[model samples]
Target: MKAAFAPTLEGWYERHRRDLPWRHTRDPYRIWLSEVILQQTRVAQGRPYYERFVEAYPTVTDLALADERELLRLWQGLGYYSRARNLHQTARYITEQLNAEFPATFDGLLSLKGIGVYTAAAVASFAFGERVPVVDGNVYRVLARVFGITEDITTTGAKKTFAKLASELIQPASDPATYNQAIMEFGAIQCTPVSPDCLLCPLQQSCNAYQTGRQQRLPVKAKKEPVRNRYFNYLVLRQNGKLVMRERTARDIWQNLYDFWLVETDEPITALTDLNLPDELAKLVQQGRLTGNPVPLTQLLSHQRIRGQFFLVDLPDTVSMPLPTGFGQYSMDEINQLPKPVLVTTYLNEWLG
Candidate 1:
């Protein structure tokens, strides 16, 4: 079964592979870009972003030279801003330190910033034609079900088990890249997490999960931690037509993105005074009247759910008011240019429009 695995998967890929732009090239920079953009993103959703990035910064040198703010702006709406930041940092590292050349080996690719084992194997196998298997979520599901690996995938021992099996499976493959892509593609389209197409699956005969009817239970992933609920009260100070916003600098979610003055609470509040703002903020709130009611918004992240209540405080345009430290007033044009969390963007569109 191990000897024929790669050939069967490669055959399946030759017939079922989707025509994606990244598959057409072996350039490491483009391949790396696609991998970074597609992290935590589906292909259908990430394809346009990939095209935009390739069009905007065609090479490692171009990416390294891009302004951080502008890059973040381009990467807005793609959750996990750290991926974009890491991509930029790695690009610069490659351009300045490595003469704009990607490391050709799996070990070398793993040494790059934010390049994990999965990413390293993907770049090495796909871009450099190295005989390394890419073991991401899709691979995990495929290997677990076909081999009936019931070990919890989140544990270190399970990871080693899967990695060892993956390495062994790729040894017989004539083309490592095609075999890797085929298994991942098969997992995604045929053996999906829910309602897998087992009826017409090519691997049905060999798939232990299908034969045992344990397809949904083989890749034993542990339950995730409870989602932490946070309440964010945004004080949107506006004068004339400009609004006040600041870049989040804390070592927390939405870092490097722009948002209004935020006051987080353990519980939801109905009124501005519930915030018990500092004297300076209270004075600012006093100077301005609330505009209508507090607009509510919510965003769900990987492990946190944020409920935001935006309180619009319209100060008199006749006299300029001092904003809180690190906060700056910007026109609608400027606000439109800044990178912001999806929650902030939703508020701007729904409230301002």
Candidate 2:
């Protein structure tokens, strides 16, 4: 079973692999960019971003010299901004410390910050032709079902088991890169978590999950923590055709992104009067007139659900009220250029029109 496994997947991959742009190159920089962009993103969604990034920054040095704000703006819609930030930091480190040379081995790549086992193994195998396995979510699913692994995938012991099995499985493959990509693609297209196509699978006969009719049951994983609810009240204070916005500097979600003045509440509130605002903001609100009805929007993150309500206040052009600290007025054009949260962008598009 072990000997036939690698060849079977290789043959399948030759006939089934998609023509992704990254597959045609052996450049570690491009490969790393694609992997990072596609971490929590689908191929269909991340492909354009990858193309834009490659076109913008063809080499590690180009990426290293890129403006952080411009980079974040380009990476706006693709949530998990930390990935982009880390990508930049790593690029800078490679350019400055390592003379723009990517580490050639898996262990060496792993030494870099944010370069984990999966990423290091992928780069080493795909670019350097090293015989190391890449174990991502797709690999986990493929191995768990094919080998009839019933261990809880979220547990530490199960991680070790999968890693051991993955390492052993890659030992016989003639091309470790092809074998790694083959299994991941197989899991993505054939052995999907739900409604896997077992009828035409090459490994159907040898697959324990298929024979035992437990395809969905073999890869046991613990349930995720219940999503916490958060309520955000945004005061869109506009005056003289400009909106008051501020960059989020808190060590929390949406850090470094621009948004309107925000007030978080323990519970949802419909009216602005319900808020126990600061003395200055309260006096200012008394002077300004409320615009159209409050616009409500919701954005869901991995572990939190944020429900936001926006109150547009139109202050007179001659008002002398001092703006809050960290807040400044910006024209619509400037606001459009600033990197903002998706929720804020959605509000602007829907309400401003």
Candidate 3:
């Protein structure tokens, strides 16, 4: 009976699948590109970035040669920046070490930076025609409800269970790429996270959760970790028609992306009056080198809530500027060329646009 459903799914997939750009290609680079961009992002949101990336870096070698900052600039506003960083790293490894060939085997793909089991399975089957099953969030949901799986979808152990079940169901000699694509698409558009259309669902008649009326409760997800709040005070410092920007080198959020001079706090400040500027800037402030009023902004990440305050300071030529290493001065045109955080970019776009 489970084997019978595979053909039903493939048939439904052929008739109802959305015309996504990645589906029309067998290129491993393009397939991997789509999978990476779509991670933690909606299809509608990720599609443009996928298109832009394919245009910008047409091949794996092109991606490997890309400057990290330029790649980050292209990937701005798409949170999970670590993905962008790893994507570049993987591309470089493939180009230089693998002779521009992506790993054809699932385990080989998994050996690359940022390529986990799910992503590895996706590329392996979709691009290489491997028989492995791809068990992503979508697959988890569809299988949990249809097969009556009670395992918490968030746990690591659930992956093995779901993968085993999916592998069993994949038809012999069936196109694993098409089967994988069909299941993911079915989960994306049909077995959605919210309010799935069970009434018209193809598997409704045979779905165990649907029959048991537990569809909403079967694919249980673990509770997300509690988020911490951080306060940021960005100094948009300028002197002699140039602005100061620094690269985040520490093992922190937004690593390798450009940002302004920052003062972090555990609590929000009522006013900029309580700034603890470095000695050089404080001395310049004694002579009143500060210009515009501080601007306030807020950013929300997966595990962090950030309240940002921007202080615009204009220094004089006579004043000696004290900058830490990994910092640079750039004109607006040059600044436009560097990759920045969306918060920084959004603020600068108004001033520079």
Candidate 4:
């Protein structure tokens, strides 16, 4: 079966692959960046970011030397902020410790920050022409359907099984980059998660799942847990022409990004009078640090719900308010340069209107 899989996949691939930007280059650095960006992100959504990152940091050395704030700023809209941080750190590791040289082997790439097994295999095969199998969501779906595997694809056992099977099927004689792209593209466009275009698929004649009338059920996914909701009250304090914003630190979701001063609660506070402004906030009001009254704001996340308030405080002057430890005041223009959570941006555009 493994003997047949590679030729079948390669044959389908040669005639039907999308011409993408990353596909044209075999540069490991670029490939590595694409792989990292595409993690937990769709290709369509990631493409623009990929282009921006390539334009901004054209080399491993460029990414390594970029300021963390600047990197995070560019990655603002993309959730999963950790990926950007890891990418920056990994570039530094490759340039400084490895002397601006990328690891030629799978193990070496895997050792860098956030380079997991999937990324390592991808970079190794695509950039270095190593005959290593790449396994991602697409591969899992395609293989499971073809083989009628019933185990939950999220389990460790399923991963090991899929990896082993993929390894046996990788074409040793083929261009690794082409082969990798072929399988992935086939899975994405032909063997899609929803209704697949089986008629256009080259493997339609021999596909086990199609033959068995179980294409929808073969690649079983584990059920996801329910999303938890959270509430946030943001104070959009303003003085003169500047707005008060703070940087979120290591413990929060948008770590190292700037946002308005926030007070979170489990339930929605219907009225502004209900808010218990912290001592610092009271002091700001007493000192005429606010320009306008506190306004209510609400936001939602995949797993969290936020109910917030915005206080357009008019400051007597641009005197810096005492911020929470690790937070600092930024001007409104400065806010534009800092990376902020999407929710913060939403609040800003809504109230500032």
TM-score of each: 0.65, 0.65, 0.63, 0.63
lDDT (Cα, tens digit) per residue for candidate 4, span 186-223: 89988999999877776776678898888988798766
Candidate 3 local distance difference test against the native: 0.85
Candidate 4 Cα outliers beyond 4 Å, as residue runs: 171-173, 226-353
- Residue 134's lDDT within candidate 2 is 95
> Candidate 2: which stretches are off by over 4 Å?
227-353
Query: What lDDT, from 0 to 1, does candidate 1 have?
Result: 0.91
Candidate 4 RMSD to the real structure: 17.7
lDDT for position 296 in model 3: 75
Q: Count the backbone clashes (under 3 Å) in each candidate.
A: 0, 0, 0, 10
Candidate 4 to truth, TM: 0.63
lDDT of all predictions: 0.91, 0.92, 0.85, 0.80
Model 2 compared with the native: what TM-score?
Answer: 0.65
Deviation (Å) of 236 in candidate 1:
50
